[model samples]
Target: MRILVTNDDGIFAEGIYDLAKALQDIGEVIVAAPNSERSATGHAITIHHPLRVDKVRFFDTTIEAYSISGTPADCVKLAVEALLKDRRPDIVISGINNGPNLGTDVIYSGTVSAAVEAAIMDIDSIAISMGSTNITQYTDAANFVCRIAKEIIHNNDIKDTIININYPTCPKEEVKGVKVTTLGVRKYENTFIERKDPRGNSYYWTSGNVVDMEQNQDSDILALQNGYISITPIHFDLTHFKTFEKIKKLNFQK
Candidate 1:
């Protein structure tokens, strides 16, 4: 099996390295990611500037890797359309991210966006992230990714779906179980810190306290909090069918 591994944590990040290394046991891993951190860069593709890709020797060359001067979405899009067009990968795995991409925050996650890009191309994908900031637990997450990938390879029913996996902060042994969950409400309070630059220029830094408003237990947020791994099947289609049906009742003339 050929796996295209990627992340928003940059090519040099240890998270990607650990992921690529661990994934090698399952398949041929080719990593294409941003040269610098592109965290929270949604589904943006570079159009104004030429995307520059550089061949790099990552982790002793067992894993073929490239660094792109763009966002996470750009990396996977370019890889599928240009880099690996001759032999498309069996699966696209985006992350082993150092942070959690739970709830509605997936909308802002470059890691998840990478997988979404793959789904747009009709390729099976997985977006894996650690629920904690700790990098030490990436091994457990990567192992879980292999198991999930191997199992999902045969189940094409959810062919266009993106499996979003978030590992809990606790140790692997302590993990309760896996929970199939839905996206929950994760909003942040709009608060910014005004600061002065070295030249005394005013700058505003955006920092908001997270406000989770999920009342249901079937949410990814709640599952993670309950010490279980959260696996959410997500897609790029944002059409609300009920809302569409409601609007159709109005029957406005074109």
Candidate 2:
């Protein structure tokens, strides 16, 4: 299988590097990622500026890697449309991210957005994330993601699906088990902070921490907290099914 690997944390990020290595064992892995961190960039694309892709070499791997001056989604789109035009990838895997992307946080995650973009192209994809900010042992998370990626590649029924996987910040043995979960409720406080520059120009920066909400035990965040890997099936369709029946009763055409 031919797999395309990309991330929001840039091509040099330890997470993506380790992930690419792990995935190399499964198939031909190509890495194309942002030149710098594009965290929380969501599903943005670069249209105003001409997208530039530069080939880069990292460590001993001679993989064809591109450093895009764009968001994660742009990297995926460019990889499919421009870079790998000769042979399309069988799957696209994003992340092994620096931190967890749980609940509503997926909406703001560039890591998840890359995978979503691949899925939009009718290819199977996945977003992998570690549950801790500390970068001590990302290899464990990469190994775990490799196992899931194998499953995704081998499962024909899941060809049209996109999954988000989160690994807990713990040793391999301490991991409870894998749990298929739903997005949890994430609350936040103080989204912005005001600061003054050296020239005394006032500016505001967005900053906030995720607040865990109490929900059913089957939530993605709770599963990560309990030392289990969380896997959530994500879809691009954002239609609210419960509201459809009520809206249909309005009789707008009448």
TM-score of each: 0.95, 0.95
- For model 1, residues 1-254, the per-residue Cα lDDT tens digits are 99999999999887788788888898899999999999999999999999999989996656789999999999999999999999798899999898899888899999999999999998899999999786565778888899999988878687889999999878778999999999888888988889999999999989887885754789998998899999999988999987997887895785
TM-score of candidate 2 against the unseen true structure: 0.95
**RMSD to native for every prediction?**
1.6, 1.6
Q: lDDT per model, in order? A: 0.90, 0.90
The residue ranges of model 1 lying beyond 4 angstroms of the native Cα positions read 197-201, 251-254
Provide the lDDT at 32 for model 2.
92
The positional error of residue 56 in candidate 2, measured at the CA in angstroms, is: 0.7
* Model 2 regions more than 4 Å off: 197-201, 251-254
